[model samples]
Target: MIPLLVCDDSAMARKQLIRALPAEWPVSITQATQGEEALAAIRQGLGRVVLLDLTMPVMDGYQVLAQLRAEGLSCKVVVVSGDVQEEAMRRVQELGALGFIKKPAPAEEVRATLQRLGLLDLEPPLAPTAPRPELALKVNFRDALREVSNVAMGRAAALLAQVLGTFVRLPIPQVNIFEVSELHMALLDAQRGQRLSAVCQGFIGDAIAGEALLLFHDLEIGAIANLLGWQPQNETETSEMLLDLASILTGACLSGIAEQIDVRFSQGHPQLLGQHSAIEQLIRLNRERWKNTLAVEISYSLEGHAVHFDLLLLFTEDSLSRLTKKIYYLMEQE
Candidate 1:
């Protein structure tokens, strides 16, 4: 049996990758939550082959690859990441990775990759003595939502990077169930007295209904406009730039979530919520309408700039149960 390490911060992602592995392959698997642990495991000769993830808190995949090369650790690595930006794959390859498999990994694709790497013999099937159960992942409601949001945010970041010609740094999304009154406190990005501008769009499809909002720091507008080669000379031009950015981020993110849950969302035209408004005021205006909300807040920043923004998805209480049901169905599938 082979000793393989699956390193990813998200439990859901780890489970998905394990599911994508060829069931017929004989292997002993070790799970690592971050690059540091993965490195430790490799040093112990536990990782003959490593399936690595790029975005993690303590240490990222790039750091792991660099460390492996520095220590001259002999191990095969295949990067599995949600961040599909072009440079992501290129950097991994340069750092000594066999290849990359993007998120929502398909089982056959994983098999094909391993076969190409000469890691699997697929032409002749070997029957097992008994049935092997799928990875036993006890994912709760919040983590499941976070995983969905994680994949969605990655797609949005890739889209924004292409539009602005820069890399977008992704953070694990914060998922919560909040009373209308407590919602504003969660958005602490505006606490430094930085004024904020926002765009809001409403979406509805089948049992899913939510609002997608993009909150941008007023100060970052000029830098963002400069990147897109649209220097905002006037208030109207600045507003136009803000709208364009919101459309790209919110549209891509919302669509990503919809695709995961197998639904189609018809989004309303994004409206500029307000310029230079407090986050509290923004939440308060809609507070009376909702008793509770399931919020998935994704924060993103540019690679080399102070450009930062928050993409928020607010789902009504009525939609929460349906959303979790969909997640359960997703997890149950082969």
Candidate 2:
């Protein structure tokens, strides 16, 4: 059997791709979590055809493609990424990727692509199958939430870009249900060994009320100030600039999310949570308040800049049932 490599930082993505492959096709599949590992596997003859994800820690797909070209490696590469931006697509094509597939790839499309590439022999397509009974409800809700979050994130990024005058790079907004204690662990990407300054703003609308926390690494202050065309000559000025930045981002993001759910939010004044504090410490201090909250984390990266921050929205436990119903209602409308 021919060997195939599926490389993605997300285990779920890799599994989805594997499942999407034609059932009748015979191949040995290998998996890698990042570009470096994927490259190493290719060099070792683990696979000739690679399905790669672009956004990964340690090494991304772009770097892998560049290195592959530099080393003159012969491999068929297909990009599978959540970043479906036009520029992202053009860059991967220029880097010699055979094709690009957006996230949440349809199984039929995957099968067709393989056949067109001569990787799978031409055969009759299989009939559609119903989703398994146990997995249907859970999968539908998660998928709907993810899709809505994607749209909202794009809106937020667009607003941020307008404010920064530079393209804002957005990763896929992650949606998950985790206890407040587990939130610190889930946010390791945002708190990667940096002292953070946070701003918390509460928003209420009908039965849905949540808090949006904007977390910025203290080291990002200068870059943010310059982006906002502010010359902070003193500590007070710096603090003001930081708060202004947080207000703009959190406002735009929360507004975008609310717009999607057909809710109007009354936002509160931004409250400064002390600077130069560990992220875990900040969360731990308020752990009791949010112990049972449902948190949605969105990490925003500014392109052409060295600024990175996270926006976290936390909903009270009692509001979850209402939130889920609203989410489902929105999904049904779509």
Candidate 3:
């Protein structure tokens, strides 16, 4: 195995780097506390690549690098430093460093780069991505994930109906994959009384569960009332009904997802996003982190009724791939 050395003054930084490396990297790694130790290690001809930090005690990275280069050291050097100044990076390149990794580099990105450079062996072949079908369906990768969501959601609804002692109707989940810029347009559509009242619970598993929004749009709520043989006198009464509806819906959705993922999730209580301009209000409430919405909205319809609802499952773009892999993995398991 090719040996790599990590040279940094701080243990915490080293730990973070180690944690980010892919589990399957083939290289055996060693650590050096400072530039002097790193130089000593290099003299011993131990490692092929030396990951050098910029700042160090006794001997800084620049001095160590200059000395090593002057002496014609052949080990590949990758500068790993928090300093992102253009000059620093240029200088590292001038000193014969093979690569530069910004401090706090995302783990997956780093692993991929290393693997491409032949520093690490290849990982197992991932399951094939879903192919374009003969029918030429107008769907993206998001749609495939939505199908996974649908199976999980159906199971969730059944679980909720069992808990609530009421016949809960779930609509087929509709997924929309739009950029952050499209969120404003989606809100405009959702605001024109198109928003559903939903109760939501948060569940955790592999990554910490972010908040979950369980909701039904206007049509689903009306249909549910009709299915249950209740005539809600006003919108307020209809909204109140959705409190229980949202709870049941959330239960079903989480249950389905958890079952597919083969893991349990910690859940939180559902809440109301009911208002005259409910969509706008809900978006504003989560404005800080949800500044840009890459949302997955699911709608449930009451069985044998016209009442249908909308549930918005929002996540950032970064998490979308993890979500996809999880769904795909689950599908393969089945």
TM-score of each: 0.94, 0.60, 0.46
What order do you get sorting by TM-score, best first? Answer: 1, 2, 3
- The candidate scoring highest on TM-score is 1
- Give lDDT: candidate 3, residue 81: 71
Query: So what's the TM-score on candidate 3?
Result: 0.46
Pairs of colliding residues, candidate 1: none
Better of 1 and 3 by TM-score: 1
RMSD of 1: 2.0
lDDT of 3 at 97: 79
Candidate 2 achieves a global lDDT of 0.74
**For residues 1-334, could you state the per-residue lDDT of candidate 3 as single tens digits?**
5567778765544555665565555455777868889888888876577888775668878887898988887687878775444556777889887777875556877776676666664334333334212112233445445554655554565554454334444333466656544765675665455645545555566663545665455555555676556788986777667766666666666666666556577777666756545556655665665555456675544434555455666765555566667755643332
Off by over 4 Å in 3: 1-144, 157-172, 191-198, 217-226, 229-240, 291-294, 331-334
Please write out the lDDT profile of model 2 over residues 202-277, one tens digit for every residue. Answer: 8888688877888888888889888888889987787787778777878877776677678888999987777656
Model 1 ranges with Cα > 4 A deviation: 121-126, 129-134, 188-191
Worst 10 residues of 1 by lDDT: 122-131
Count the clashes in each prediction.
Answer: 0, 0, 18
Candidate 2 Cα misplacement greater than 4 A, ranges: 1-139, 187-189, 278-285
